[model samples]
Target: MQFYLDGYRPGDPEYRPAAPGRDESSKGAAALPDEVDVLIVGTGPAGVVLAAQLAEFPGITTRVVERRGGPLEIGQADGVACRTVEMFNAFGLAEKLVREGYWVNEATFWGPDGTRNGSTAGITRTGRVQDVADGLSEYPHVIVNQARMQEYLLEKMRTSPSRLVPEYGVEATGVEVLDDGGDYPVKVTLQREGGDTAVVRAKYVVGCDGARSAVRKSLGIELRGDARNHAWGVMDVLAVTDFPDIRLKSVVQSPAGGNLLIIPREGGYLVRFYVDLGDLDPADRDARKRFTFDSIVAAAQKALHPYTLEVKSTAWWSVYEVGQRIADRFDDVLDAERGTRTPRVFIAGDACHTHSAKAGQGMNVSMQDGFNLGWKLAAVLEGRSPESLLDTYAEERRVIAQELIDFDLRFSTMMAAHPTDPAHPELGGVDPAEKQRMFTEAGRYTAGFATEYTPGLLTRSAEHQAVATGFPVGQRFYSAPVIRLADAKPLGLGHVAQADGRWRIYAFAGAGDPTSPDSGIAQLAAFLGESEDSPVRRFTPDGADLDAVFDVRAVLQQDHRELEVEALPAFLRPVKGPFGLKDYEKVFTPDLKGGRDIFDERGIDRERGAIVVVRPDQYVAAVLPLDAHAELADFFAAFMQPAAALV
Candidate 1:
């Protein structure tokens, strides 16, 4: 799974163009068609994820445009957080990316004098901090460059049923949102690199085109935040170094040579150095123009002095002025009074928010932005949900963007100041202890785990919060190991909630009551098997494939051998494949590794079964009593098109 880029180094005779079809003109190439359902700008992490998700809907047509001629092979953001890996796992790409990248298990820290600082340099380990998300996910922080990550996603999109192919060497030069109600409400002007121009219409458009987003500018959106006073140099290099923590993720603060952030990349020999370039006037054009490979590598050498460091080869390098900014709104228009607004033109990722890439979140958060928006957009486009559901995308993600900016603002300043600078009296310059505490605390948010959304049409009241105390409303559902009752194979509950874009209902059947017909689990199963009028049936539109829009799985607290698959109600175990010869996935048991129970891990009572509703993106939407059929039916009716209405 490890990937190697050959014959394409900078200035090489065989070097490929940054983008393909860069020399092709409209006269030679086919012009863009008049319309597409979803037109996405930029093929970065956000754009590719958006394209891939939109391809899932058969009725929707998705197209992505990138200015680059081809996918990048290296450089930029690295570090896939635990939650992001869970998302990739849900979509069937986590294992592939994990295999191709290095899993960062611990972080190391160094002080001004090149001495390790930690409680175990007798007090703490300088280069080995505790893993922040140790129990949060099965996956660890992975170090795959953004270029490679996008390539993986792009390949997935290419092989998908929709066969989505992004348009390269094409850029969005203009966007016009049509006020007149029509099938295609957005007009986008695309220009190829060779001066060929064409216009394509779309029901919706999204900008994932980095900080210099033409889409955002065309839509008149403004980014609100200030640029930092410091500049930084980042380089991906293959090097021979005597530094002991070269392989570990290390944060080194120097009193004179500037701070250095070391990130070990996929290959064991390659490392990324993020060197603080000290204070420089943002308005000084000449100073900014002086950065080069030699200057950047010199910075890295100075930061790690006394330890001989020699760069054998460099893959990529860039000088960046650190800053934080977020769009005032994710969408172009907002009309709350109408209860419906055209989410026609949108911005995400760097187009919506920009921060220093040192946190390894630029690409991760960007991909997640698409992750959060894709399902909502798909639901609306397919008439599965109302337009109002679309508004929640901006509402939920904007807050996260602002929070990220705030964190980076503080982090940039802390890292920019020298370890011995007198200006920062609070800690007498960069205090390694304080920095470690803050960095760990920030990981909770940066790792994308503890983010809780507000209650909207998707989330229900907090009254039932006690039912699944560990799985809260409007939060991504936590995972725990569970054994399949039919086979006794252990697996995490999240594996069943894969990112297939389906609403999931988990019926935790607490210690089965075969003797009582009216008991909680029995009553629920009876309702499901009764008829098409069952609450479960109401969730799906008439004539629609039941599994296409939603999934229902039972988690029973019963021993694998003791439980008979035939004894389970029809609803708990649906039949599928070749004239119903095969059973759908069987109910899972709470018992897991080390005899631990998932019910206990999630704070669910083994005697009191509960019904948990999970959104398409796997956020826990609601938790109700097992017998709350009426309430459950009403819940689906809120967003889903009723069977009667569909007919």
Candidate 2:
């Protein structure tokens, strides 16, 4: 939210000033570039997010091409996780999305009343629980159309300095990785509607074209998993229902009929239902053809039992068989043990993983995949980091994709299973109460907050976990209320982060006054600001803003009113922008007005203090002591390149 440094624009400050020769007017008027730093395939959640992130860096030449004629209008995935909302906030789109989307606060469960003649009776309310656990995230689990989500991201890209716009009606037909070391090492072949083809060279390629990705086929990667043989009919409809929990997310289990999952859409009148269509016969290839929209409605009517549903109109409906699959690898390097080779091609979203959508993780996880890889790609292409930094994309995201598939398999199985049958002892059945418990427990995972990257080049070991217990080294940086020392404005500490391809170093003050020259924070700030080997001094380009490559900020233990902003170290209040304006929003204190002490809430050691380093994507990369200046420099040295070297 820092602004007015570039002589004050009248419009929104979030809209960055357009780069030279790059603006909304240039979109589509300029011919396609023969070469680009990155070429992304598909306009889905993954590709759009990646393109949006790259748009922030005008120096990076990025292009996104899609097979579709235009933007997605309707009929696709919804159900946005809380973590995804946090990412949207980083891109400055969360506010609009939350205002438009439906918040899922509670969920109710329904099951048959009692066993009758080896079957269940009429359905009855079983249990009700909170949809997302308290304190999991500041953002709520939202239900919005995937098309709308992409529209917001695309808008961000269009308004960015690069004015990035996807080239529609042109699709990637093939990909080939080159052996010789050149600026553009990957070749991509694209085809238009009229059968005209063109070839483009790129430094890197990302395939987000979905389950039947042609780029993935070019790489010869196989999606390895099994189909559950169960089929479910999903539909978005405007309907009148006697079911009390129609607005609330509900799971209905009927032994005599089949299972049903009801989710209310963003609009108050629209709702979506995943009606169980029973097990699919392996031998029958045309089983899905036999079930139509009318059959889906009939199945929903039966599943509700005594309750009734009068459908007014159907917005979108489809039949899908339950299946869980993940690609063998996400990058171009096939054999890891052979030799050191940087990845030039990658796959994300449904292009790399496929699973049942019952867990509401498809779109959420897919967007995260793009977020995880976007910054790394930008850094490498800008010469801020080495090409080896690209390897971590596959290493980290592949594990998360596998975990999603495993969880989805278990969750979809429970939702599809029938209630217990007393007469049929041989056939195992799902207990209604147990199913409810599982749903409540899986909230963290489904909300996208449970992902933790393993220790690697990007993440540090938990040896310093005692420094900042709340900000785990390998997980997303958790936010807490903080008051701006300069303006007394209250906001989340994590809200300061923007997807601008810069690292974050949060220096929490110890018990001693941070203004004192002898305090731990003062000494640490001096080292980071003045030392020759400090990451800030070495990685930042000559004459650039002091916080250009690394955004260093401080959090004090005392109230903002008690502290003097002028007395803080220069690094904590660095001069930036073309006008050399002193950035005042960098310093923060505990949110006294909100009655929350960040140190106490996040388990920060007030006596010792801590430094939490967060990546561009908002994941905590390292947690260290306030005076661990050497460790801080060493951590960044592993990945970041010295600015002088690029010159």
Candidate 3:
């Protein structure tokens, strides 16, 4: 039950290289075979991790293709967050990063000192970082170059059992889905890259090709959101400075111009700065665009105090205008106007959602998008999941993408606005109150606290759903709960569930003698009673049956709650045997977490009580909010037992 509860830390040992023969490459891109079970485009964080996850699954032919050729061979690189690193460890890339990357602990804030102000002590740090959760995770965060990571992935990928074709760029200019709805096997198309073109076929296709996603366009799906060109500078340099704040600083700033951040990496340093060329007058804008490298260096020097800052060679550098956008529908038909029919096309990374990279969440969010999707897709592909499970990927990830964009909007707005105050530049433009607010929120996001999936139904629609529900699942985060499997206890009612690892929920309430094998739920209850991962408590039949303590199912029938409850992540399993659970509430009962449900929390009472159905993923199936348990149950019965419904 404690598996992955607290993520792997510096020396926690989950980090290890792949079993060589399975991942290493065998032949050149041209020589490699063409067909596969899954073809993933783009080898960025999203693609790489996805490939890694899929490779571990048996009977799946997965491949990773990057138009840009090999890893670290090109492309500008950046840093990795704790979450990214944690994932890397899972896929066995963290150790490589740790060996080749740098560790940064703190960040600094700077502001303009004068009209041509040298610099001001705006905010002293990027923001307070999260203290490593005790026994929850090993390292809080790490700064590693993007290219280096790609290199590491390339080496590891060479041995992947999945067929990997790194340089075969997809010319998915226009593709018609041959099997639009028959489980997407053997898609036929022609591909062109490097002045070469040919026909190709694959069982599946993934669009990780980024913003100008070929798969998305081929599906004829149009992006559905706004895009803005935000100005920002990122440079990875060999700084010749003994600046004490180098390792500690996260965000650097200025008043008259944009600021710089000292990303104290192991190789050297990566500094980032924000700029706005939009409001600039024509002359200033044109002149600045054509500004020489000298001006950029000058800008850098102004922000960071130099000891002997001579420009060593630039390891990687790029200036990106930040932008934000989202797709209207997860999938669409490829008709002339908007595609005639929906294709089994899936898009991850920037293709699905794009946003300005400020808090370093772009990579993290993208990786998470892949994580939430990869396992589920594999499930569907393996025939373990209902086709409806695939739909959940879009429904869930869309909200996450929206959350990122919203955060970036607020962060970027406040970041670009220079504080009018000089004495306390860190305060931005407002008084102490606003400064405190910024710091608090910044700390929360920077610590990755704002990143967890909500416990609310874990359902797709959030409007009528509650944000938190279920027993211990999605109930608490930062550490998955520990349950005594032997005791068969409930783990998530509030004080259980952590995001670090999966959970194995059980119940000692099964029928039979507490000592009989039938009371194996008893053995499970006993084991969970001592497990150290999450809190496990036995149910009290008299007043603790949960029926008395909370009106869980009752609230549903009353339409008092609207959100669905989420099951704990599927990874959690029985410690040493097949998992088991009490029969699902043999019958929908009147018990609901008291009369206090999500809607009731808002002080809104329903005119009539109805059935509050809970879906498998823990979202409100439907809030009948009326005491019609039979009717509500019948509707769901139709959903799960279609054939039975007709009879």
Q: Each prediction's Cα lDDT score?
A: 0.76, 0.90, 0.47
Stretches off by above 4 angstroms in model 3 are 1-25, 28-35, 74-77, 95-100, 112-138, 151-156, 160-171, 179-192, 224-230, 268-291, 304-309, 333-343, 422-439, 449-472, 475-477, 480-647
State TM-scores per candidate. Answer: 0.90, 0.97, 0.64
- Global CA lDDT computed for model 2: 0.90
List model 1 lDDT by residue over 261-303, tens digit each: 8889897889999988777776786675688889888888877
The most accurate candidate by TM-score is: 2
Model 2 per-residue lDDT tens digits across residues 1-647: 66677786787676677787785574661246899888999999999999999988888888899999999998488999999999999998889989999899999999878743333467888999999998999999999999999999998888888888888889899999988748888999999879999999998999999999999999999999998888999999999888889999999997559999998999798899999998989899889778999999999998897788899998899999999999999988987532478889999999999999889999999999999999999888777899889989989999999999989988998898899866685798888999999998898998998799989999999999998999988999999999999999999999999988899999999988889999988998899889998999988888788888898889999989999999988788888877878888889999987899999889899999999999999999999999899999999999989654323
Clash number for each model: 12, 0, 101
Give the C-alpha miss distance for residue 643 in model 2, angstroms: 2.8
The residue-level lDDT of candidate 1 at 35 comes to 87
Task: Return the clash pairs for model 2, or none.
Answer: none
Residue runs of model 1 more than 4 Å from their true location after superposition: 1-32, 114-127, 335-340, 421-427, 514-516, 529-535, 643-647
